[model samples]
Target: MQYNYNISRITLNDDSHQLIGEILFPTINNDIVLLEHVFINPTFEQQGFGSLLVAEFVKHAIHQKLTVKLLDPFAKLEFAKHPEYQQLLINE
Candidate 1:
């Protein structure tokens, strides 16, 4: 099934919109982005949105030439399901 996905990034202090899901990268320094967290509402799980979110985040990191430091297990699991993303495993 095709899903219309809308994921947004929330920084440390920006609170102006309703967040259905968020992937946190609290530290962006020295051309590196620490991809620390990824959360999708429980009601929204298993619909393939989480993979979309993580994939988009990785694309953003690559586009900016920034190294991604992933610290979330969920992110790892999601990436594992996608063979194309295997090389981006930061912990490997």
Candidate 2:
């Protein structure tokens, strides 16, 4: 089975200003941002594009004083394996 939902995409570019990768997120409530899909094109995968996308999202969230909830597969794993992530989950 598959589930579909709307995502707002944000893209970043290179020095030449060419688009490289995109991050997709869903807005929840009026004060939360739920990151749903994050992809760094195969060609840009290991170059921190994913982190950059996350950082951008964080910046927006901070500006709006919104809580950020990343509901991706790795978020669960990180929650399970990292104390910091677990604390974040608990704090929210």
Candidate 3:
């Protein structure tokens, strides 16, 4: 089955709007937004940019009163193993 969604490219402020990350949202249902893919240049990693992007998207979700869903490959198993992520999964 094909799901309907929208993809938005996040850009930088410099001369060129270099692609930083992307935000995906279901077109049929706006109540939930998926954080599909988020990646920063290796050189730029660990500088809070990923968090900044997520924070901005979360802010948007808050303003829109929408639920945010994220799929983390690494965190999946770890989440299942941990209490915090397990709680988060249950909440979701």
Candidate 4:
């Protein structure tokens, strides 16, 4: 199955045709983004949509050179799994 994996500075959506999940990373400062929430439709949970959202968000953060001040537990877990994304964290 192919998920849309949409990405933007403030949001990540799971699909181009449907909204299966989302990640909210709002800017907190010139160089920081606060990862406020990650919401995957309950029906879509545990199917990797959330992880794709985080991965795309992290990539965008890296590309934009914005550090992530993680508030979302879901994002924290995803971020913890990848070493490449460590430098993108604000407090790590």
Candidate topping TM-score: 4
User: What's the TM-score of each model vs. the native?
Assistant: 0.65, 0.64, 0.53, 0.80
Clashes of each: 0, 0, 0, 0
Scored against the true structure, residue 70 in model 2 reaches a CA lDDT of 71
Residues 1-92 of candidate 3 have per-residue lDDT tens digits of 11112344343322354444443434225465454556555655666565555545545555566654556442243335544323222244
lDDT of each: 0.62, 0.58, 0.45, 0.74
Q: Model 1 scores what on Cα lDDT?
A: 0.62
* Best prediction by lDDT: 4
Worst 10 residues of 2 by lDDT: 1-10
Q: Which ten residues in a row have the lowest lDDT in candidate 3?
A: 1-10
Give the root-mean-square deviation of each candidate in angstroms.
6.2, 7.5, 7.9, 3.2
Better of 2 and 4 by lDDT: 4
lDDT of 1 at 37: 87
**Candidate 2 per-residue C-alpha lDDT over 1-92 given as tens digits, one digit per residue, 9 for 90 to 100:** 11122245577777666567666766776765676777666877777666666656555555556565777774454345545333223146
Error of 1 at 22 (Å): 1.1
Q: What does the lDDT come to for candidate 4?
A: 0.74
Native-referenced Cα lDDT, model 2: 0.58
